[model samples]
Target: MSENQYAISEYHDADEINARLKELVGQPLHPIRRDKMEEYLRYFDTKCSRSKAMTDEAKTIIPGGVQHNLAFNYPFPLAVRKVEGAYMWDEDDNKYIDFLQAGGPTVLGSNYPPVRDKVLELVRECGPVTGLFHEFELKLAQKVQEHMPGIEMFRMLGSGTESVMAAIRAARTFTGKKKVIKVGGAYHGWSDQMVYGLHIPGTRTFEAKGIPGSASRHTQEFYPNDLGQLHRRLIANRLRGGTAAVIVEPLGPESGTRPVPFDFNQQVRELCDRFGALLIFDEVVTGFRVGMGGAQGYFGVTPDLTIFGKCITGGYPMAGGVGGRKEVMQRFAPGIGGTGERAYIGGTLSANPMSCAAGYYAIEEMERTNAAILAGRAGDRLTRGLKEIIERLGLPFVAYNQGSIVHLETGAVMLLDVRNPVKLLKELKPRKHMMEEMGAAYMSQGVVTLAGSRIYTSMADTDEIIDEALNRFETVLSSVEGIA
Candidate 1:
């Protein structure tokens, strides 16, 4: 064994020291009980009667009273009427400073004049799809390549899920390996193969019902930040013909379902190299939002294949595909047993001109103005303000960010700490109802945010808007008192 392996084994063998280290690392920083979070939720429930009414009405027509399952909150998602710049007008004619940013795609903000004008112009000219190549496709792909030089060739899809599904298929075909290893809690779209251990945790299982057990049979799962465990799994699977690829979010910097250390990704890259497995970075969330070059550039560990979406389309319905070494991606070309043998990837609306036009313009705008840096600055200001409030209130909460992606979690630090751990675990357990309440409260106060998951900033969000949101956050948090 190598020196590093010998040292790791020796460290694990030291039972007494390991126990002490675990205890030290598991101490609570702040102690806020789960019951308080629940109480706060109950209070918001009473205050958000309008939201409930809307949800009830929506249930009659829409599934779960929302278009996407992730969009559904405890009270009900507010129906949006119109959005311009960084603000949204909901169905009740209430105005809100929108930080949701269409779940991170609207980095340039909704209805930005330039992108809007271009999309409308395209619509007027030739409708959405033509079943033929469009000029906009090449333009957008070229822009993506220009920004992130790692992506030599690219494809477009309708959603992040579709892109991820296609990337997985391409990886399997390219490597001739059937199994894939994914991080336990990182979300990578809704396909059956990538669905295992999604929102609903524990082992390899799907969050949605009716998923075939056999769908993820060859798919293995590993915890983030545990290199030894990952290596063991890779070796075990390799003995049986190896894995096609190891797919990860590359930034679980925040520990939740899978909080990873900074070195975790670097180590994972080394292991993948040793195992002869392709590494796939699912950058749908981190794509253009985190930086113009995505997480790969931020971390400086290039992957064999990378998947992108969200911010690339600038909030349009367009999603994107995998890009990597020429050889691996060439598996998609014809005559390698034709299209039937290699990855048969296609979509009716893939790379439609309208989306491509919007995407190309959006990327151009972001680069021209360096909007990503501005967005990061805004996120920093907001997170710092929230953290200050939490400290003053003596609340057990933590706030952190990855460039523009920000998250605020109550009891997150305590959950990570605490010797017994059960108390914090129970407190942090899925409080969907509480999250919905928080969302409604924020909405009523004219500040919109995702329920404890992710939030974004836009070029249109001014200092005044951010300040307003922070002040409202203080009020909402104070109102909750001992709650989350």
Candidate 2:
């Protein structure tokens, strides 16, 4: 499982990377034909009847008829029965290409045989959790720190939000400062403090409902790719209290939905050094997927602390964590007797045998098969074909990919100013509906994408799979063109 044995390809070249980025042309979002969309909605009702019945039953228990926000799709949520490499069969036994990949984990593919078998065997033997330490925990840590050298010390959490909460605490404790800066739109997690400015950069308190103002008073937001604004914010924080950390999703918000300059992260690292602030890269999505070492390694900009999510356990449940160098990370060390500043974070399920075993083998599998590189190639082919499709249709819909993390921006509704009721009320619903319809359109034609607007390609998506997906994608476009 040595990383050196399998050579990972470079993610992107600067010139070509910008071209792909620029080619994400659609912004205000061309609305899909209304007549065609209504037809698709009618078709969904009949086609997904079983899903509707199951969702109705689940709604009686679960608040939204689904446990997670991701499950909420057009028409109704799909209750899946089976998952394999690049494909899923829902409750009604409808087959579709699974581009969602469980929200970007399972880079090797959904329910990968090797990792799943090992996990199942371990569960049968030692059990899921024994409420005590296990060997797999140490092995998982060793595997992670082996590839990501920045992680001299590591700790696990039940979810990515917990890791973010832990990272914020550690940064403040280590630096003895209160203020934290984050790039707007770059989601770290749903933790209260980190929700100050979300969905759009510089949108302070717009979506911070149910969260008190005091919760985020110390947490400020700055525009991505704008080092000058960050400099100003850092300077402002220094007057009352120094900035403890600057948190960011290295790929920009929504995984490059708002793309950053290639050198943006490096410059942020330099600024953090100058300002005595800790640099925290929330690689919850990008970690292990961008490369064996994550986005930091790909861009050659190391952060003081890193957060991980889906890639941690390769789509297994209870997968998330934080890691950092010895000096800063040791703040989480137990047995300190509450004398020193420690970020109290741990979940009953965190680092259990099941998650640890799954992660150990999952990372091993990724390295063994050159999964990152292969997935990146699949993403390249997928995005390329999408661009050609858009051109052929003469549509302005935007499509781009950063390695395996892909985005198809049918509507950048997040960019709309919710402040203006007139414009917001007029524009939001249709654009949002466009996104949902696009997603439903893709699902009907045998593909399942993330949020109906984004995609996360996997190593399972080979050329043949990509070609199959492209055919389905063209059908989705045809729905917009009223081509039946």
Candidate 3:
């Protein structure tokens, strides 16, 4: 497919976006007015009494009353009883526009009937797993390879974290090197080495609690979009044991929360080639969301290896994999098939029959409906509408999208980095709180978002749905303290 055929029709200028983000963080917090905030919070206490009570009871057993960090809403997490198309109903039967989209995996929309029916049929026929090979495994692999030609060989895993671990291990084994470098603030996974620089650049090990120092000694990070800094690290690692791989989220870290220039990936590929290090694309979010061919296709930059995540199974469980050129992927061969060296990765439920079938059917469905492009249209509409709202309200918030992955920076919380330690220390708490409040305000207005900052639009979001969402968003944005 051509570049325009993919989801992202236009790539935002990364430098300009970053400059606007800097200006946003430099300003005072423009949170919802106190009266408006209290009124919104009342929605949780009164209207959502059932959800609040249920979460409170679960808090006695579950840590933070939620298993996933994304569920950590400001007032409290809501118990979702139903999801379909572009909406969700909480336990209290309150409806919300589902902008979260199950954290960007449901591009085809939540609980899509076609995919779900196929899964149910497969379950009734042969159960979920069989500890052996199935035809859908080959079908899923072939489907992925058909879309992402760079992924000549593929290995299915349990989750995105496992896929990252496997990719790093394969890179090291193939190159006979020990070090790996990643863009600071990019979230590849929670593995020890990958956790070195979490959230903010230069804050290495800040969130590496309980992980020993030795766990990440060989891992390093450089500032986002700084090719010079990356080149320096590549040269430095040369004097040591040499770099194994340089991994990145093709759009930017945290799903383009920090957007990179259009040519950033191509430059990184060149540096990797010059330094004899493998380039890995952590496409956990961008793989299918950007297009059937992924960000590599969008940017026309091929990586030695690419990681896959939830969208592989269309939001089903056990959705992760690693794919790339045949030579490097050979390192993941199991049993006695390998020549001599092996990466040695295993999972009891990896490539289960249900997951494979779900992935195969999902990809087929995505291709048939051109879901990525449709979802991207929804994202474009939503983003344009959000920008209009922010502009009309005279707010400092920023909004942008890379296809279906949309970011609305109300507090610019994720933009903070250790590059400005004093500023980080002074504002991190209030900024984070403001982000949470923004989420609460949106929820009260019957819109669900990912932490009040990120949103995932799906093929199900029609122009009508997007316009309605924009109206709700305006309700919250207009409530900002300084808004006219």
Candidate 4:
């Protein structure tokens, strides 16, 4: 198959799009009673007062009071003023031991002196961006290739979404196939095609607004742990022609959404091979943060293509690219009018010098200090401590990790009553709310977390910080239990 032969066909039908929208928007109201909504709102107001005020100010300018949807909560999101080694101070002059770390970018901690120095030095020399090429991009690409051997070739983008968009485009072009399959509940990015089944159960359509249904008509989604479901979908798609690629987070459910069973990823890899479809690992969150080589390296299951972001730039704006077998990547060569035909994958700021410098320095520091190994050890310590404390309190929670990505899930809430969607959504919402509340409480006490998600450890997260966080977690759990 050639790239030019597999061009995408347009299907624009306003009536069909409108009808689908009506069907989705006309779904019945949430089953929760007024009392439940009132309770949740009250709790949100009480615990997130500072966030609320900031959100109120933000609403005037930014939509939904935040630029990114994930940045918004029920009340609002806090505005961070400044960040240091392992801490952040909010606009309200409150300090927190920040674990959010800019959604997995700051693997080395906020404002590390080494990275900052490198960035400053580069900026002083030739400024931030130039239309022409720079040496920093080559240095960063070499660093990434050193760690992830699967990347025989590389490109760069502004965010994970752009990289993923290009990967899907390239896969379809390479395979001469139209359809793509993704794991349900796993978020690859916000691009139109990859947005299907995001936040499933309640919203099975597009996750965010403005993403047309026709744009995702060729995409299919299947649950993470169900190989049978995957097999069925692949078979169905193959009967119609064949799927181009099956992109997924190797550690499913968006990395931290759930602990991936050891066999799940291996099974998916096997299925992709069986179906003759390329398997892509969207390692946006797990890349370089989980280990030196990301999830594929940790799991020992190589994918045809891998997408990276976040930690690649060390909390900077630079994201990453699509990398795969030379044969597949060669489809983008200039001899074939590659830039125009193969996959229109270009960005003005792609692989710019400033971001390249940040990424190169960050990865070098991680290698120099063996940051991933140390982070894994720190994760083990924190999880063990939390498990012991939760057991003593008889709290319904479990703490686990995949390398440095530490997570705690409420066993009592997540395991209760899985039969009804309404009940399940209701239960999950409160549990999520409580988790956020606990995070806020921890912040008030000078310990910050990744806001109910997994925590990314840094070399700066010393033993004292870990011990203090555990102690505060115990205290916060007791308080929450009393309130309940």
Estimate every model's Cα lDDT from 0 to 1: 0.70, 0.83, 0.93, 0.69
lDDT for residue 382 in candidate 2, whole number 0-100: 91
Q: How close is each model in CA RMSD to the real structure?
A: 7.0, 2.9, 1.1, 9.8
The segments of candidate 2 whose C-alpha lies over 4 angstroms from its true place after superposition are: 1-29, 417-425, 481-484
Name the TM-score of candidate 3: 0.99
Candidate 1 has a TM-score of: 0.85
Candidate whose TM-score is highest: 3
Task: List, residue by residue over 1-484, the lDDT tens digit for candidate 3.
Answer: 3856799978888899999999999999998999999999999989998898999999999999989989999899999999999999999999999999888888899999999999999999999999889999999999999988899999999999999999999999999999999999889889999888888888889999999999999999999888999999999999998999999999999999999998899999999999999999999999899999999988999999999997999999998999998999999989746567799899999999999999899888999999999999999999999999888888889999998999999899889878788999999999999999999999999999999999999999999999999999998999999876
- CA displacement after TM-score superposition, residue 360 of candidate 4 (Å): 0.8
Of 2 and 4, which scores higher on lDDT?
A: 2
Report the poorest 10 consecutive residues by lDDT, candidate 4.
Answer: 2-11
Error of 2 at 200 (Å): 1.8
Clash counts for all predictions = 3, 0, 0, 1
How many clashes would you count in candidate 4?
1
- Pairs clashing within candidate 4: 97-448
Which candidate, 2 or 4, would have the higher TM-score against the true structure? 2
Q: lDDT by residue for model 2 over 1-484, one digit each (tens)?
A: 2333222233334345434444433244565677767776776687788899989999999998998888898878898999999999998889999999999988899999999999999999999999889999999999989988888888887888999999989998899999999987777778889887787656788778999999999998886567899999999889978999999888887787777767888999999999999999988888999888888887778899999889899999898899987888888886536655777776778889999999999999998998888888898889889989987887766677787888776666665553455666687677787778788888888799988878888889889999999998987786565233
Off by over 4 Å in 3: 336-339
Error of 3 at 305 (Å): 0.4
lDDT of each residue in 1-484, candidate 4, tens digit only: 1211111111123234324333322332222234443554464456556767877888899877888655654335777789987788877666777766677777677888899999999989988889688998788878888878888877767889998888888888888888898877677888888777774422447355787778888888776556798899889998888988988887666564534565667888898889888888898887877677777776677888888888778878767777777777776554334354476667778778888899899989888776666666666678778879866765545565655567665422323233356766666666556555555555555566665545766666778878877886766655543223
lDDT of 4 at 48: 53
